[model samples]
Target chain A: MRIAVVVFPGSNCDHDAYHAFKHVLGVETVFVWHKEADLRGADAVVLPGGFSYGDYLRAGAIASRSPVMDEVSRFAGKGGPVIGICNGFQILCEAGLLPGALMRNRGLRFICRDVFLRCETSGTAFTSRLSNGDVIRLHVAHGEGNYFATPETIVRLEAEQRIVFRYCDPTGRLDPEWNFNGSLEAIAGVLNEGRNVLGMMPHPERMAEAILGGTDGIAVLGSLLDYLESLPLKGGKRGEVAREAAGAAQKGAEGTKGASGREAGGRCKAV
Target chain B: MEETMKAKVTVSPRRGVRDPQGRAVLGSLHALGFPEVVDVRVGRFIELIIEPKGEGGPDEVEARRRQEQRLDEMCRRLLANTLIEDYRFETEP
Candidate 1:
């Protein structure tokens, strides 16, 4: 499969992602600069982790406005698969491709360590290879990875099964300490309404090989490839209905907040 | 008569950082008998005042604009991270 990894100023993980795809997955990969507007015949795109724009303003805020993001948005709109890791996830949120926003760690500390993530939904192309509740270990390194969203949005995401992963223990038990950044509901990742776009705080690329302690991440990447291979040669009609539904849900939640004195719940669960 | 120009710039996390200061403040508030504090984040404020360079001349506006622009740039490049910090400025004469 052809893959494109977008590179922006201060993006340090682009090369790492390239290696994962090129060496481990044996896929044809290309580096697309953030200024480039074209995907150059790529079937899927990966926004690698790193401190884009030096994590200035917000981890992914500046990079979201980069020129290449227009193309990325269009590609996602066309139903192309996109996976954003770490800061890339931040950018996706900043670009509005994903719901919610990444906030500072609740502990006000930068966390860098191996984290456990429980698979929430295996129905999507990103997690089809894994079983629901499957636990995978990956590295999470960031200061601002906490995810926040209004209550209605969280409810809709849960109802739609859009949440993909949650911070948990190796035994797949929800543990607060396993939550690296205190993400709402201990969410480590989520999928867009289309389910083709994914944003996660953990770095799967860092654990794609056995040498990295385990090969759990390979399954996640493999799932993407499997899904891409299953797609019809011609791109399918984009899914706008899901987006509309999500927007409506957000509005409903906002309206509820306006009328009631209740605060929004955590994206996953209240800690 | 001379006119003075003033500008106020406020800088904050593009996404508010988990603020230990705010948390501490919240803890103190809780100790003082308030427990509804959910989260807290801190931000900064900066203000600058300058004399009008010239009466409505391009040079004056350009220079002032450049100065303000420079300050904004400095906030992102040095004072704040373009990624996690945002800044806004207001000007008055």
Candidate 2:
């Protein structure tokens, strides 16, 4: 399962994403430059975090109009799984691939810290490994992480079961105090209508390894790997092929654009 | 003949959308002796100078119309994100 991580100018987390997928998780990952128009036969695409175009106009705004985005949009259109992390999420929203817009944080501060998030749904590839009500911890750092949508869109998001994660206390109780960014509904992540595109203000790549203080990211990223490996014709081998392909992918890393996945946040519940 | 038109575009959060930045500015305003300021809305201001292509006098009216139309299109396509903000612009020769 070859994955393409698109990089735009000023993206800072591209290497982190590359390490998580290629080195830690042993997945075949590639770096796709933002100036390029193709995904190069990659199965899924990742829009990593960072200040693309220096977050000009708006976070992820300029990068959304990059050449690679058209290809990413087309890929998502064909049912390929796409994940936008942090600024990546902002890009997805700006590109109209996902609903809602991320505005300045409620308190008007650039918050950087570890937060808890409760799994709101188990239907998406990003959260399939986790169960409803499960809580995971990831890092979040941004000045504009507050998520907003029109009332109608918010209602639709709830009715359609597209919300993937929400902030909560350690015991999984929802509360306003825990909604650090003041995101509407205390939302931390959401899925598109197709259930293929996921945009979250948190960085899962930053926490994929246990040495980094936790392995909760496995439930998210690993679930994606699980989904990919389970594919009959599209995905092949877990025993040996995955390892060799991953090694080859690391060697081919020089060929594209990149950005980092911003820190992630998840609400906590009773384990 | 070549003529230049000056334009200004304004983009702001729609009513009912939260305005944390505006609120922050309002708080500061109130602190600075502007108690009468009960409401504040932060917005972006952009200026543009347009040089309409094609010959000028014969198609002046048509050129102006197309210039305005393109300005509107630019706002819709890039300058403003209608999902959350409202945008309007005016041009002058």
Candidate 3:
């Protein structure tokens, strides 16, 4: 299937995403300029990482209002699979396509390193390849990756099981030290309520190849193909796939309701 | 007669949210022996001039009302991320 990588003016990771999708994953990929109105017949869309618009007003504020976002929003409304990485995640939050906001890091430092992420819930278009509670390593680099949301929104997100990934240690421990950006509950990635859109701080494309340090990210990237293959060969009308996925996620959350009595539980109640 | 209206907007992090930069500044102040400064917060200040849309401006009351509304919209839509930031504006007569 063909994938479209949206390129903003200051987007630095566009090429990395292109290389991973085209060279590594062997998927037909094309670059769609920020000003382009149409998505150029892409089955999936990726908003790659970068300081779009120089991150002037805010990390993703200016880039969110660019001309092409209008199309992206429409594409998302149709329940299309869209992945926003790093600054792209910030842009999605700014554009109102996702819940919560990526505030400045709690330590106020630009953190750039490899971090471990636990697959919080499975069946998502982005993480369908992995089983629940799997740990994967990916590189995260950002100054404003601290994810924050209102207490009510957090509750809703948890109840819906939209939290796709959480920071963790190699042994899958959810301690504060593993949280690279101090995101609430160590949230590294999240899915929109519709379950089709995903926004995350870590760069999966960066880790898609073994030469680049790790190939663990391919599970996240390759899930797109797996998801598309599972859907009926209709013209991108896979709303049922998303619904079934969300149903599984909700069940997973219900199954683990009383099991996780850790810091995340305390923080949730404290809110 | 035409008049140019000016506005000053101040944007700051929402209370109860962690402000690392502000905390760093507070630490520096404490190190400098300024114990009197119990709290420190960082914010942004922006100023802009706005002209009425049509050839001539509306009456003073209507002009101020329109300007205020536009400024609020600007802050909500672009200038500030209301989720994590609070914004206030002052319009000059």
Best by DockQ: 3
In order, what lDDT does every prediction score?
Answer: 0.76, 0.81, 0.83
DockQ of each: 0.17, 0.79, 0.89
lDDT of 2 by residue, A142-167 (tens): 99989999889888788767789998
- lDDT at B45, model 1: 77
Tell me the TM-score of each prediction against the true structure.
Answer: 0.73, 0.88, 0.89
**Model 3 chain A worst lDDT run, 10 consecutive residues:** A262-271
CAPRI-wise, candidate 2 is: medium
Candidate 1 off by > 4 Å: A234-271, B1-7, B11-21, B24-41, B44-89
Q: Residue by residue across A86-146, what tens digits does model 3's lDDT show?
A: 9999999999999999988988999999999999877567777787789999999999999
lDDT of 1 by residue, A107-187 (tens): 877888898999998746677678888899888888888888767888978876788999998899998877767788998
Q: What's the ranking of the predictions by lDDT, best on top? A: 3, 2, 1
In angstroms, the error of model 3 at B32 is 1.0
Comparing candidate 1 with candidate 3, which one achieves the higher TM-score? Answer: 3
TM-score-based ranking: 3, 2, 1
Task: State the TM-score, rounded to 2 decimals, of chain A in model 2.
Answer: 0.86
Clash totals for all candidate models: 15, 20, 0
Give the deviation of candidate 1 from the true structure as CA RMSD. 8.7
